[model samples]
Target chain A: MLHEPATPVGKDLAATYKMRLGVLMFLFYSLFYAGFVAINLLNPLLMEVTILPGLNLATVYGFALILVALIEALAYDLFCRRKEQTLNNTQNTQGEGN
Target chain B: MTIIIFLFFVLLVIGLSLYLGKKAKTSSGYYAAGGKIHWGVNGIAFAGDYLSAASFLGICGMIATVGYDGFLYSIGYLAGWIVALFVVAEPLKRLGKYTFTDAIDSKYNSRGIKLAAAISTLVVSVCYLIPQMVGAGVLVEPLLGIPHGWGVVMVGAIVITIVATAGMTSTTYVQFLKGGLLILFSTVLVVAVCVRGLTTQPDQGGNVPYYEYTTLAAVNESGQIKVSDAGWQVVELQDIESAKLTFAKLAKDGKETWWLVSEKDGAVELHETQSVVTTRDGQRLINGAPASQDNQLRQVSNIEKLRGASDASTGSVSPIELLAAVSDKDTQINLWKEAALTDKDGGKVTIYYQKVTPGNQVMRPGLKFKVQGTPLERADFLSLMLALFLGTAALPHILIRYYTVPNPASARKSTIVAIAAIGFFYILTLFMGLGAMINGVLNPADSNMAAPLLARSFGNILFAVISAIAFATVLGTVSGLIVAASGAVAHDLLDRFLNLRMDDHQKVRAGKISAFVIGGLAIVLGILYKGMNVTFLVGLAFAVAASANLPSIVMLLFWKKTTAKGITASIIMGIVSSLVLILLSPDLFKLYGLDPATAPIPLSNPGIVSIPLSFCTLVVVSLLTGEKAKALKLAAQQ
Candidate 1:
């Protein structure tokens, strides 16, 4: 059975993990948010062009959302695996101290 | 065809529920499918339970009426599943016993946590259930010509019986069945669309010219306006009368064919008018206005009328010529109302609609969102978008699905599957909506009828199957919600908080009873909130869920420093604040159309402001109370 190990952090590890996670989350959320804002703002403009044809903002946003979600899921899995590896290494070092 | 298929499918669902009820003898068996369902089946069931009537019906309706904007909802909904898969799924499955409260109280053993979590679950689940019930009512009203209220009651009774008898076992199977049927049939429908191909000419089926009568002053030859005896009706040279036009039949072609009216001395002449008007903006104003209601003048019939010279049956025109012939500028019909003529009863009597050329303003978004003399309504639009994006992740029924799976791995896998299924379905929505728009099956009376009516165009059998699937979609979702609420009441409140110490069998029985009670309440609310958009109601549910449950769950999961007091405070505050904000919002005021002072708040969704507030309260209170609680616990241990 694989068990999660608790590592004693000297503040640095905790801060680093927190900062990395926060940045990643912010980036992921912001990308989607930017898409949303852009579509809502530009939709009306797109409607103004006579030859271009009316575009459905929802369909475009939906496609963007699916793509972003796929990327975010992949990023999250990678982060978790990396974090797990670090935690495992720390546990091994603490066992040597004991 | 619609009635027979709908009844047959509903009966099959009910029969399956009854069978599952008998098998679900234990509490775990009833509440969480004995926590032993296959990941693959549960994944599809997740799709079934998640894709409610709102997704299938409301989205298609929105697209038919509002064009591209309607498809945006599908994107928001599917995106929420990503949050579920990575953030909540695994940890939730690992922590909770049977209910969401179990997860929170497992670490703390606090009565306050149990009570707060239970309350939040009940509130969110109930809010979610109302829309399903409303959708059920809407479906039944059109299918059987019964009142919407009766439909709500019937769905309520059926769902309650299902949940009360079998619990999650029944709910899962029903959702699984529905999920499979929905995907299979919708795919078939999409293929049908590809096969039918896009045609400019109207099919031979009976088609009506889309008409709207606007009232204006009517003038005579001498420029004298003709007035009725009551002085309400005026017959001017160019009189316009606005009449509330109801939809009779869908137009066969994408362009409406009309007999242009030119009146002289109240005598009318009919001229064949056909032309497609394009707005200066990119929007293709079919006849004269926006494709649908948001723009005043655009009208596109389902199929365009084929000219005599271009008739393919006569082998007179090639396919390219057929397309070109219908696309010709002269092939569009534009209708404008003359004037309002009032009768002796003080009511508008004579109304005239004349075919004319459509103008540029028809294709643009009107002044609805714009404030007078102010900048664009960015704030209001942003707030709404935020509410939609965040609300789905916070919904209680969705959150509870994590508990239904056995392990975190399964939960994660299920969420991924759900996202894939939901995403695909959303893609289909574009075609479905466009197909309905061009096929001439859109119900002007209700946009919600788009998908089913679209099916009707193919034949009665397809219509019956589509309608049945739609009804089943409502049933599956409503059952899941009622089950969630019932579990909250029985397991969290009675067993945990009240300290009943009941066996699994007793707990299951209690849950069943609660399901009936809550289901009845949902029916009443659904009937009261009729004629409103289901999608908007769903937004409200998401807002409340995000505000009430999200803070508590997030705090418990990440912040070890969080105390019993902090969790309780946060849950109570989140629920109260969000509910209070929604009740006071502009929607409530506008719904009543009365004094703003009488209403509590000006905003419709509280997620924009209330979600942040809840998170802040949790953080501050946790920091303040954590140390003392830990010290007390250490002292006790010593």
Candidate 2:
């Protein structure tokens, strides 16, 4: 079983990169969610406006938020996969050189 | 027939449990499924574990009754998973062994951390268990014609068996099966709702509605009946339940009495009933008559006309059209009004009222949250939203799932999959809730029945399928909670804290024993909290989690200066403060038959307050004991 963490510097590099990306996505998504809540609290009547022929602002905004979440998840995965691959290549070359 | 189907589902679950039990011999196998669960299956299992009775029943009911407010929970819950994915998942997988306590205690061998984390896990688990058990009990009465307590015990027994026998292995499979089934059936229901199209009135199949609408502002007290609005003097209260109800007894102002008196669009209107029946066989009766074998319940539909539509009915509108139709300000919908009315002697009687609201108003947030409500109400709304947003990553059951996957990468992948599955299911809830709302299927007595009842409107077969899935939802969640709780007891308290030198076999045995005890405690509490809304209870569980667990997890991972003393102090402070705030909140006061105004805490959700306090406690304590931080480095090296 793996006892300690693998290569403190390597883990830290990935962790820092991932945390920055994650925090950005989290904050962005949170702001989007909070916007909806703010509308409800400040000017609920705005929700009644027709955003589409059959859809209102509230319904449109709600579904839009769900879409954003799915998009963000996909983005995070792709970016992290790339970062991990780059780290692996550097470590492999270093091992071969040694 | 419902009993047979329900039994079949239950038996299938148990069979899977026993089959999986064979693989879970070791403590790791029993507690964390040997840390070998495939990311895809574990991802679905995460959904199964997270999407408890609250997601399935409570959200649907809330949407059915209140429209858009219910879906807010879905947004918050799914949002929380983002935090888990980005923040906790990989680190938790990398660090933790048997339990969440293992992760927090990775840097320190402190007894205080073990005790505090274990106690917090227990508290959160028990609080979470109540809702699932309550939801199970709610399902039994309608599905099996049994009392609520039997349903609670039934679920408790099944979950205990699942935990005690196979532990995480059985739990993962059970969760996977139910999770897939829940999404599948919910999709089927949503499709049915779409295909049925938008209609002003549900097709009654020529049968008349049981109770008539009445405009008479009549008072029924003991044997005296008075219609003050019509200037009618007090008369003998007619026993409508026993005797045949006649128009003559209810007539005033030369108008025959309408059976239902409704307040719609700020105007009180009278409505007439088409049919009423009384049954003696304990079989469910629709509008005073016993239901047919296949057609058991009457479908509820919106009574008011659709905005800009030619007539009272639209032949068949698409899903998008349905949303548009309801969003039209000209559209009128009948929203349920349930209030607890106390009589002169302080006896509480729940009165069911139907408020006909405009579509514009129904589709907004103020219905339950109330912008115009008291300051306490607004605070409660903000607090609940805060709790749901922060609580998802903090839940004991949810956090434990991270330990099931083998590696950090797998953990992250599984979380992404869970988000996809859970997010899709929540979107479906909007349609299901609306389907129930407009169909006239809501049981005013219990809104939690909205989803299953909506399924019944289509056919008894669909009803049985949905109810069984709901029952499975409860089982999957309760078992996950028990496993987490048991892990805390055996790994953290017994072995780590008390210095019990148990081998692998003995450790697994200890977990099973604790599972049994916790399951029993859950059953009793579930019975005690019967009839409460499952989703509301879940919100409280989330508040406790965010307040007590999240700070410790987040600070330990990111804050380099964090000491063992800080983590322990923060957890204790968070748990005690949040629990006390919740107990003294207006919601609890109301539950205890006291006026809500009597509660000491103004805000019901403590996350808004307690979470920050916990973070501050940790930071301050860590600064004071910075020298001890060197110990964490040594422990990490070992």
Candidate 3:
């Protein structure tokens, strides 16, 4: 025997989630582009101390770039999820009123 | 003993490969280690796969010889990973099957996308593989004292065997091993550098003496010259006093110790006490005055022979007094003219003294070639930088690694881990390069040998370890590239394009055969392109990947308007444009010094132009053909 599932606000929430994700994705790319330009300008000074044995500023910066990218990607994912939840709650309230 | 250690390392690697090969029973297992690898393990392997021979050897050599500009490559390489993590990693993992083609063709059942992607994969993989093979050849030269061609052959055979036997399963494990060993040993070397401080010594032998030009004249009592217009001559100095001196003195462990020294004038001087007894001029003082015409000037025998007579009364030579004696510019022990060439024939040739000074532009890029009235030759340089920046994410071998992990989360974590490991190793390379430069062990003929030779300075034991690890690093990366190429050939081209209905066993067999064939081709290309930098070849691979595959993948995922025809056109355009541009670029002319006049293209990398073009082609074509595509999709669903 199949059990009936509880009603969940679905299509409206999905649409809002997609829109919010699209906007966050735009911001993510924008931030990375800004960081890239900033780091590119500072590369010369970083290279100066790179002559020392064992410490390389370029490699350190590479690690920093990866860390920043990870944070941006995760934040985008979370923002999309939260926006989807908010839209789902709004759709549920509207359905009850109707 | 070195050979034994090397053999032991090789045996250990082979054993690990066999163990992993046994576990690769299924097609998925063979292709991506059953997609069960931990992010931490895969991440380190990613570091292993990315570092390659270029990061470990070429960067160090470049830094030692070229100075700051060499480190620029390392910066560009690291920055590219940002593009990989932020834009490519999670989405690529979430997309389709074994290859990047799978992802693009998922939305549209388009044969055109598959064909274009497979061809692009082959081109990029072959290009990327060449440098790893070349690195293998370079490593074998010093390790076995064999010819470079033999080294290429050996690496090709080994990588093919590994790829053919187990594919990605073995490839991943090998890369993980290499990544761990590289980081661990490099850290040990760095600690050694910190522990052993720089020092100096007098009477240090075995160093080749440097020669400097000095003019000398012989004068009689009437001031007549004995010889005029002499050329350069080699002279041995009993002692040299400099305000700044960089040299390596031997330490207690037999490793060379590097030092930088500076001394003030009047604090040091060379006091020659030997009196010359020549046939032309009997017994004359030679320490305080310049040599007279008849007085023969000979190099002093020892530091004792250069001791000042006035300082003899003081009994012991103080460091300050020793410095003061050598710093005296007024005292001249000997004066001799350098040798010169004179042509008596109609050719009219004579050796003349001229000062040489390197220009400021020598350190900057674009000095060798320039585009007049433009800032740093925008087209060629920008193309190269763009290729480097975008290429890592697009690379087939790097892309396929994402599939080796379980899910998108693992792919993301692995990339982060890779970034950390790779970043740390690159940091070590800078020090290793500077250390090699000051160690006085850098080979003038080859910059690629800098890291290995630097290790050699510490002892043969360290040298053997580093060289073996380097050899293993090449093997791991090459195996990974071959596996990716083989998968594209067997899975995408043979199965999907040809519509071959084969059992899983047959597919694996075909992939193995393809791996062997591609591995052989990689060897030939590597041998042909010996002495060129490996990093540049990798950049070319990236350019092709970004231009050809990236646009199609991104469009299919995001654009609802994308059509099969649009993707096909985009892939074909991306592949054709980037490859054609690279083949005709000035780099081809400069690398082999081919005539640029005949070259059809001007830019080396097409990413700056071709990437945007591909995206636009997809969009415009999709919009125009959207209704026709809509009907086709509707009918297929029905």
Candidate 4:
């Protein structure tokens, strides 16, 4: 595909970076979610233990999943922004040299 | 008063639709809101569209009845948006102009791809529509004093008006309005739950049961209901026309009692209630009053504090304390347990009994999805979860929302906003459900009514507001689905495949006509599926979408070698396989008034099998065709 030259150069750059980060976050989140489900399947008794005052492990784990989603969203946005900035800086420098 | 508020909300929404309709002269405006919606509003609208009856009414009811199992749905639904935000939102917006099918057909204007994708969209959208319509019917009976069928028809008419008038623009605003109000009012209800706190306090104001029963000696026209001290004589009966099953009042020694009668062979038998009474109107009341809105039980029952902390019933604990207290093993909480009882007619009627469950057990996962059940049952549970987690990003209606934004970045931003709003709302459901459980406000017949009934426990005013908001929730979701289905029909099927060569005006007109047809279809299905749990129906839709649509969409975005033929084949495989599996699944058999055990398919959800099947179809076909064919097709299109 690269030799064919049909694809844009920067398109792969952003796509690669985004895909890598996105897959990583997705896998990481899935592991946590799977853990919750696995625990429910394997030994549901663990969910009964109070991890905090007035809160059980199951409830805490559920809320933690939501927090993790928010954090991942923010992290992805920042990472993409930085990548775009780097790409723009290189283009500017090349233009100046020309 | 409730009716007045409901009327106001309905009129306001209809008026807004007509106002927005003026701008929908063009197909772009009608289909994608002219790609002019603000990212912020669109994000909230996404939440509105996604929440539906399942998230608001279904999850809460599940939690109220079963405990921690319901929150799992919230987690699965929200996790799916992460896929949308990180992977799908930007790419879909960049690719498609109006509809989700456009994103795929953009590469090659293949009529096969258009036809297959359009059919899948319609199937998934209609499956999704059934639950929303069912939820509307559930709300109508209790809130508007109307029959369930009328409520479904009312929703269909309103949704058609909205979709046919202004299309996406009207849908978006209605979604945005309802979404914001749903979150706001839910927070109010959650706070009220917190203020009221956990209580083991028995209902004193309403008709209180004087005795509890383990069993009855006999039941007939002259059958006797056994009490601890003495027995009662059978009186008038209801629902026993065939002399199979009935509710009756028994008068014994100047005191009256309620008994459930079961007739077997030539003999009549009686089952005594745990707590029951006979009202002046000869109505058999359980606990205190009949299981109607007139019941005054307004607080959580069968409660206790942490095991070692105190044996006494803790009164008015804080919200956090309430949850923590329920997690303790010693805390005796009341939860509903359902059992299917065989009536005299040999049919099954599922009856829910109030059980004194330990808090530790309630907080655990085994109550609903029992691991101890058959292997197939356990597999079905996992399949349901997988579908829910994958379905959100694949939904035709959700995908179209991305095109409503200006750019890929806006699409990404709006999705994140959706996650935040939706996540917050799901958390509130736990409290609302728990509140409903303790408050004795649940309608024993319909789990869908738990959230609204919880509000009614606060007062009629709050009930009116929540019910109206819930009605809007159904309307917004149903309208969005109808619009998506109509687009698939008009734009993808007619214009692209049939080569109708429709102008913008003709396209909009065709779409509107399609909306009316699909809306009517949804209304009919909803009435047919009455009394079924709304949330479970949604689970089926998710499974279908995950199986049929997700594989093709994901492969198209990622794999360069994915041919139009591969895409077409995969979609057909996905749709056909999932539909066949679902039709053969036990649950559908149960719906058809057949024995569930006789169904060939073991798993209820088709995602675990059909999703992988669809993926393999896409890959195998792509590999067989090789990349050269795709390259030639692309060149030809250019």
Candidate 5:
């Protein structure tokens, strides 16, 4: 019946930054994802509409999702590294001042 | 020659494992590769670890057999990596030492957390193992020309050795090789598919039983349609405009089979194609004769018409052009759909008949998923997608890979790499599946062989190499699962409960023993769950993982009031509820020789219910026990 976090996990300097970015990305992606499922459920005929030569909305939207995931991953990684670098620099300056 | 190549790959993996076995002498080295793997190598290894037989064989097979619904599985699977990347990857690396259980239990030195998380890991790992084992069996049939049962046993034996000897080190390398080759060869195959282009009639199986379908000129008035010649009777025409098939009885032959009923311009045409049948006396018959090599079910995904292409071929068409050709209104793909019935002699007859489907229909959502069906079907689709998305972050095997990297940053970097690799591979699945569909390489008896068979359709050497890589795909995933399970047993459960002082060597010995046992169990389950769709089976595993482990992991990280009891309770509840719902599902009901319609549970997947239940249970239990746990914690510290 232990109640506390087994580790001093929240004390990490980057914990808050990581959590905020992660949650924001998660919510944003999930919202975009909902439209895919919603179309398949509500009006599936909409998926059959041929937007590109032989490709319909279903195929187009599906490919877009996979493509978006890779773009988002690369974006997330880039953003995290930049923030980490800034944090490291700030910590060094503070350490020298102290 | 194929055997030589296959054996070479097998021996290479084994030799590598035995060589690396020296490093696994210690527990840390055995469990997490001594935390020395480079991030770049680990990234491809992550792809190797994540893209199991389910991704390579199952999704491709699904797409080939049922059309676009298989692509839906790929989409959902890739979507899951996002959750893994954004939420769990870095924190899991920061906290975990060996197993995923280690991460969750780091804050609480409580026996409850150890027991619960360990059990959850074992459950999810085994559930995941079944599909890979099943996929192994399916691929082995075409790979080594062995029976399905032997294939499962062979995989179990090899993977057990992999896990028991070098543990994580060899497993990681095996996965990296598999991931790299799978993507490379798949790209080559897609290129081959594009260059070969689409053909209307793919006589790849040496023209086996190519029955010329006779179109009957039928004059119909009102609801009932009749034919004066050959004693053919259509009881009801039933909207030939939209229907893919219609029923017809031939009075002359009295054969029980469906006729291809479609509307042409303003007239209705009835056509007959070759059928393979099996009688109650165990007679295998094709076109009402004893089935032989010359008259058996051929490589079947044949296109009836190659619209927008010249000379019945669209040679060297680009990917887009190929898709466009298939989507043409005049384009038709001939697929074999099987059905069973009792004949006039009161004996059973299984019939595989031809059904001509439009290319546009093949690329849409309604083939397998029934998107236009009732609310239940829609709910099932949503449930599957939800489970897939949430489940990736919670999988014990995937979580353990986070520990293989040097630091949290490496873990983050490797995860993005995995995303790039896996996402790219899944995109290739759409082409491979469609390629198999048009090129005539699909095996109707087992859809799991679609990807391998697609290679076989083009070249023998290509098939052999692809099959070996696919076999290694199973080896890699099974290796990871066994490692995770062994860690749960040895590091989390046995170490805590035994309370016996054991060194690294002794602990490693315990882990190897558990890996062997879990591998044996996986083989048995793989054999039992034969004929079921591998992707669907993997989907069920995802549901179980998302329900059982995810709520606990997410709650532990975010909810400060999460008690040891609450975590334990949630894990147990999630496991129990999901298993119970699955057991009562229509699919399992059919498995038990009962009518699927009679199953108590309406939903096919348990995630939508069991996941929320797990979360609610955690919150309520944590609330109720917060003060009690606080007092106990203070007392223990004092």
Candidate 6:
């Protein structure tokens, strides 16, 4: 008991904001991915239906999972930076509050 | 030409690594690139490190062989990064100094945590390494006209040099370059496939040109099979009663092969113009002849009939048009299947036979994973998806990459970039695999050769370029793995757990030594697991990582009452349970030359069970130890 049990401080002013947003985006993407897997498991025949010209549900859904991950990642990054900027600006306006 | 390109790439990586090695004198420099890597560069490097031979070779080969089931891997692998970007990247960067163990053990600094995490890292890395080493050998066979053992050793040597010299810095650059070139060349190859469009006859002007299977009419009178064609004769025939399907074993010209048996208007039809038979006496037989340039497994995949096309080929079409053409009901494509049986003389015979499948069927599921087959089969598919979706963030090599970036934001930025690059590359895998499926370039015995061989179908130069990138893909990934493994050994096991009190200089030296040892071990294991499928091996690695590390990482970050003992115990449980379950699973049972039906566990993938087991273990242990830990913490604070 001579030393402090090093506890992980995973939350901070910005970290709390980031983690909340990150989990939300992650859950949204997770559901989208799960839906793709669910369709394959439950009704694989549905994957055969043509959803676009020259494209079926299987190919379209597969591509969408990948594209959505990319879009979500970019969007997540943009949102985090904007929110962090506001946090920094607010803290600066009320200097030495802590 | 392949050898020249391959050598140039290898030498360039080594030369650059040696140049960068001078700057990597400190522990941070060697292990985490001194936390100075640019987000843009690190992003592609992430792709380079992540997209191993499994992504390029195995997935393409799977798609070429099994269709849409292969793209499912692409989906799961890319989806896993969402967890990394959102949950792991920033937090891991803020906490860890070097190694995945560092991040997980940052709060506890317990010997138990160090030991468990370090062992898990080694297990996952070695599992991931076997496939890369095997893929390196597979790629090198065509590159240097060599056997697999030497190719594995050569790759090991190259990757070791990359790791031993410049460390993470050199590895990052190599990965970045490989990642960029791999994407660029794949796009080029995909465009070429689109431009070439749907062709009934592929390998247009090759020495061994592709032709559709010739179905011969025969009268099955008792045991004698009399064929209408004079050149090809079925000397002896025996019907196979398996899977409720009809197949006949035929012996002709001292070679054995399997034929699809069907009756048209009462006359038995023997289909398949080509089949490769590997005999008991170590002879490779193709179409009842010794395997040679002239006599080989006929270029396997080709369109028997193009869908809605008026000509012999659908002249230059768009990528969408290509997919549409392949997805048509009228489109008939040639695919291959393997069958095995005991010969008349008691020797085991393996035969690869051609099958005619509708384009619509070839583009859908039910080929590989069997999603709708049975409850267990569906569970296996779901387990694999869960592992892949969770495994990316849990992998030690991936976690360590966050340490290479300067800040948490940089880590997040790099991961987003990795998602874009890797997602684009995975989409191209579908195009490349579809092209290979119809282009008649896939090796009958090895689906892993699909992408490089598909590039070969385009032209020799593209093949050479793609082959070089594949080799570099192996190198980049293997180096990253070695770096992770070395950090675990030198930093976690020796320095942290063993309390060796190694200085920064001593630690870097020990890390280099560990890299050499791991490289040597990898080469030996690669040679041992020579015939294993790369994708399957990588999947097992993912399962282990997900089961072992993900729970501990997630709970440690989220749960307020999580203790060191809880983290340590769960990691061991995860590793042991997953390994045991994998050992008893049907897939490994089949690999062991035993009846898969005899496997104790029905599930081939254990993530569905083992991951939850790990989480339960963590929660139980944490609750049991919460009071003592709380008292100790309170005492220390007071």
Best by DockQ: 6
List all candidate RMSDs to the true structure.
Answer: 10.0, 6.3, 13.7, 6.6, 4.6, 3.5
- Per-residue lDDT, model 3, residue B195, is 41
For residues B398-478, what per-residue lDDT tens digits would candidate 3 score against the true structure?
Answer: 888988876554666687778777767766775566455434455444668888877776778888999999999999999
Weakest 10 consecutive residues, lDDT, candidate 3 chain B?
A: B348-357
Write the number of the candidate with greater DockQ, choosing between 4 and 5.
5
| Candidate 3: fraction of native contacts reproduced | 0.03
Q: Residue A31 of candidate 4: its Cα lDDT?
A: 87
Better of 2 and 3 by TM-score: 2
Give the TM-scores of the predictions, in the order they appear.
0.75, 0.87, 0.70, 0.86, 0.90, 0.94
lDDT of 5 by residue, B315-370 (tens): 69888887777766678887777655455544454545567788778887888887
| All candidates: DockQ | 0.13, 0.32, 0.07, 0.27, 0.34, 0.36
> What lDDT score belongs to each candidate, Candidate 1 first?
0.64, 0.79, 0.62, 0.79, 0.80, 0.85
DockQ, computed on Cα atoms, for candidate 3: 0.07
Once superposed on the true structure, which residue ranges of model 3 sit more than 4 Å away at CA?
A1-98, B194-373, B376-379, B595-600, B630-638
TM-score of model 6 (CA atoms): 0.94
For lDDT, candidate 3 versus 5, the one ahead is 5
Better of 1 and 2 by DockQ: 2
Off by over 4 Å in 5: A1-12, A89-98, B205-278, B292-295, B307-311, B630-638
Deviating ranges (above 4 Å) for candidate 2? A1-13, A89-98, B204-212, B216-301, B308-311, B342-348, B372-376, B627-638
Please report the TM-score between candidate 4 and the true structure.
0.86
Pairs in steric clash, model 6 = none
Q: Comparing to the true complex, what docking class would candidate 4 get?
A: acceptable
Chain A, model 3: TM: 0.47
**Least well predicted 10-residue stretch by lDDT in candidate 1 chain B:** B244-253
lDDT of 6 by residue, B129-196 (tens): 99999999999987788999999999999889889998899999999999999999999999988887
Best by lDDT: 6
Instruction: Name the lDDT of candidate 5.
Output: 0.80
